[model samples]
Target: MSTMLQWPASRPARPGDPLVDSFGRVHSDLRVSLTDRCSLRCTYCMPEQGNLWLERSTLLDAAEIEAIARVAALDGVDTFRLTGGEPLLRRDLAEIVRRLAALTVGGRPVEVSMTTNGIGLAGRIDELAAAGLSRVNISLDTVRADRFAELTKRDRLADVLDGIRAAAASGLRPLKLNTVAMRGVNDDELHDLVDLAVEHGAELRFIEQMPLDAGHTWDRSTMLTRDEILETLSARWRLTEVDGRGDSPAERFHLDGGPHTVGVIAAVTAPFCGACNRLRLTADGQVRNCLFARDELDLRRVLRSELSGTERDAALDSVLRASVLGKQAGHGIDDPEFLQPGRGMNAIGG
Candidate 1:
């Protein structure tokens, strides 16, 4: 384990200097949460009831989100992934995407994508795509409705299935499906989930369930691992590694040496902190350096401040740079003293 170290204060960010952390990872990809509200309660994510939703008044408006994004855009961010309890639940999602899509940095149009639960996606995908959504990552844990209803405390599996088909037909390239691999929950349906992806022209990503549950009941000993997922896959096909893992969390592979592939995000077993280039902005406007970070920089407070435009921009840069510079070498989930973030994944943005 690497000892945690604090970086020296970063000077005001310049156009080319970018948001570089102590490990020399230039932060450009931003995960912006539109809201912490969702349409379904996935067993692995949210509680079935009693989630303390952020007040409407406290949430950042579209204009405020755009302004903060513009600052980050000017700094170096070119890719923004929209996340949420379910991004589709945000009423102004299309408008938000439109505004983000219009942002450009270094003469390159910013790429805007979303990670959604695919509940209400079918109804708004066309407008979102027209507004410049590059693609989407839809979460689908099981192909069977009974298991889906059991996993997600909702019997709306058919709705998600329809949404996936519509998104596939919406001309969104590389449509992806995210599945949190659980031990006794949906582990038996791994092959079935991948087959569902093949049927719908989507790539399946088996994520190692991290300790991000709202109920804080995640157990690493019982949680599914990447090697275990591959063991399940290797049962029926010959696996071939795909090159260019980049800074992506998923280690992708070709199954049966064909186009169909599976991505395993072994976040716990294999820490990829060295190549991480992403930062997160909570729905309420807090800048989180990592998904599991204990500390955050309040951008909403900065936005609500009385600083002039130039001053506010300077302040945003300083806070954003500070968040990056203060990043720990890894998430430290394996450390003896490791503690889960105070906020769950839904609250943190993804």
Candidate 2:
């Protein structure tokens, strides 16, 4: 763990006083990474050899994570999304969810969710839902068993499918499916994936391939853009843009004459930074204002420091404020001078 910073006492932010960046964007959604350990080695996310996982001792315990969420809730962060290389890999995740779900900000109950690869979710969906998990976003690129193995380097398509079914059966309402679309990869299975979502009454979202691969070899040439994905899907089914976008990263749409809905996150093609309201916390306790940020504030040190509860809370408020204030105007992915962050998507948490 990093050494604690010498932070002076700062006033806690009230529920109305949100964590706003320099650009006046109020951040209310927090994505916390539980761990960097994952089961599959997805080609788009990590290298085949895989990266070293963080030591268990360095990770934030369930109590520490709850404390962070409590501090965030005080500052108007109502939605907390737990993420990881694969969040289901964490054994105590249900307990963490239970703790966060008990938090209320300004009398409103905090919403707790998780984003997982769905490898181990089938058996635990009931447990997670019973523990107060509101919903889940499972990462599934293709439904074909062979394609799944080729993409993730794992033959677990059956397991993921089972998990999706379990999520719906367990009443994880508004269950979401996240697919990273690439040019010649799972792009061909777009309509099929949508069909699966429709059958399960789940919201399916196609995310553009990002440059967060561990190998740093992501080529825009091979990446499927938002327009391409929409065009392809339109050829198969009619889509109407849904109203009320409201600071969401995904552009939501509904299948014409049907109740099923789908979304596309065009991070590279259609930058949504101007309305971005999300912040990130790595498993080790670093706070990042942006997913593509080059620097982070080490809040774990303060949380683990020899300080009183009041002192730690004050320091956390200050650190969070500093990180938000330092947020860039945009991610700059489309800029000529743009460069991908050194860390991969797995390490950075989705």
Candidate 3:
């Protein structure tokens, strides 16, 4: 089967417009994968040794990323989320962030944020913040060092904690911490994880584990549900629903005993496909309309081809538009015929 996704032959015609799908979903948020290389081997993300690393030559460079991002910005993409196997692994991240931050939309600078594992973020928080990184989301599954090692195959809990603190100190307040909700693993630490976030004025986000594991060993029965997570957190503290979620994935709540809020992504049980305004660009330059999408459009070919400058822009515009046009109404996780994606979360940019 061909990997390239074909543009709909029967869909309505609207060429060279904003990134809006047939469902009237306007994509204003762009998720860019800086690299597919990660430091840790999380149980829910990938196996100890599963997916191979993407070639450095294939991964988009700073200028390449900026060029594609510029195209999106012109098309009304106001915010860019830098994702990865671990985004900080890219040594030129600050420069990339600076370039992205410089992009203007409606006379305002386009937002640039990142989702990382926080392994190497401590010392660079200040530098990144200075270079136009608006905010950050760091993944910390467990607060216990032993459990962290068990979950992520790393004993870098101390380093992650330090990065969290440094991010807060650098004024990245409402610092978001991403926690993948596994059934038996780390489920017992909801309160402790929330406490860890509250202590540093961070938002603890509980993401229901999806079927994006590299090992493809995810059992639906073993996954934690959204209700189960709320039941546990509500038992510890009173949770008042925060208003105005908009298109944000995490459904937030105010912890009565704390100054900050907590969130739950609930990707599986409570999929937010309707309000999803996200588009993903893979490390190798394939644009995915959805994370679970079976197909993607290749932008690398159009990027490196012998098209003229104007022709290149037109080609990129078509690719970006087609990506959004192929949006699925929902991820269809509940449908009996639904199959897990071949690419894992690491390769899909989280």
Candidate 4:
């Protein structure tokens, strides 16, 4: 298969585009966190005990978010992806999608995507699709209901599975499943998930466990590195690497004559920052350069200020400048001295 080069060039990037990074990488992709609330409390991604969330009045409104999206499109950003603890948790989310879909980059088009836990997706998939949802990424770490309950501390495995089925039925092709590979956690179901992908024609991606929470329970011993995972799964079927999609960190591969493919995201074992061409916009309107970094600039502050035109442009300029310098050579999460941020992954819109 050829590489997916659907990105349009007519999305003209200007000198003062608010989100452009220093490496000449136009911050074309905006990952927006709709809310910090989620139903399931995953051990690695979110706190088992839960924590306080940002005040509702302080969070950006749908109109404010749409304004940011329009500004991003004007700059060169042609992709607007919605993420959250679970995007479905937001009320009137379809309306949000509808508003973002109205924005365009230059004469070109912008891609709209979303990521969800898939529990609440069944009822909302059609509405979201009708509202201009281009694609969706669903997280399913374990296939077994028992293990799923143990991992997520919820009995929504059935709903998640039904959601996947409904999404597939809705003709949402190329539905991607994100699984975090933990040694004693869902590692046993690795091949089972591959088989699930094969059965559904969906792509299953194994993401290495990342360190972000204040929970010190995460250790290297629990990590099933990407290499070990591939070696283990190779015994079940002959695998061939698929050549396409350079921006994706996943190493794509397929089983011999299988209907589906598998991907490995080696963020911890091997970082892909050099090829990183993405920027993240938190729910509070902060621009995060790197996921593990504790630094960020609150764009909400300027968006709420009395500034207009060039003043707002200058504020965004300072943010873009700071992001360039703050872009670390690589994250130090693996190092012992690397202090993990107190924030949960859900808060940052994974």
The digit string of per-residue lDDT tens for model 1 on 222-323 reads 789889999999998788999888888888899899798889998999878887888999999999999899899999999998996889888888888889
Q: What's the TM-score of each model vs. the native?
A: 0.95, 0.95, 0.94, 0.90
For candidate 2, give the lDDT. 0.87
Error of 1 at 116 (Å): 0.5
Q: List the residue pairs that clash in candidate 4.
A: 28-77
Tens digit per residue, CA lDDT, model 2, 65-184: 988889899888899999998899888999999999999988989889999888779889888888999999988899899988998888998989888888878887789999999988
Model 2 TM-score, 2 decimals: 0.95
**On residues 18-89, what C-alpha lDDT tens digit does candidate 3 reach at each position?**
577878777889999988889999988888875688888999999889989888888888889999988999
Clashes of each: 0, 0, 0, 1
Ordering by lDDT: 1, 2, 3, 4
Q: Return whichever of 1 and 3 wins on lDDT.
A: 1
Extract clashing residue pairs from model 2: none
* CA error at residue 62 for candidate 3, angstroms: 0.6
Please report the candidate that would top TM-score against the real structure.
Answer: 1
Question: Candidate 3 local accuracy as lDDT?
Answer: 0.87
lDDT for each candidate structure: 0.88, 0.87, 0.87, 0.78
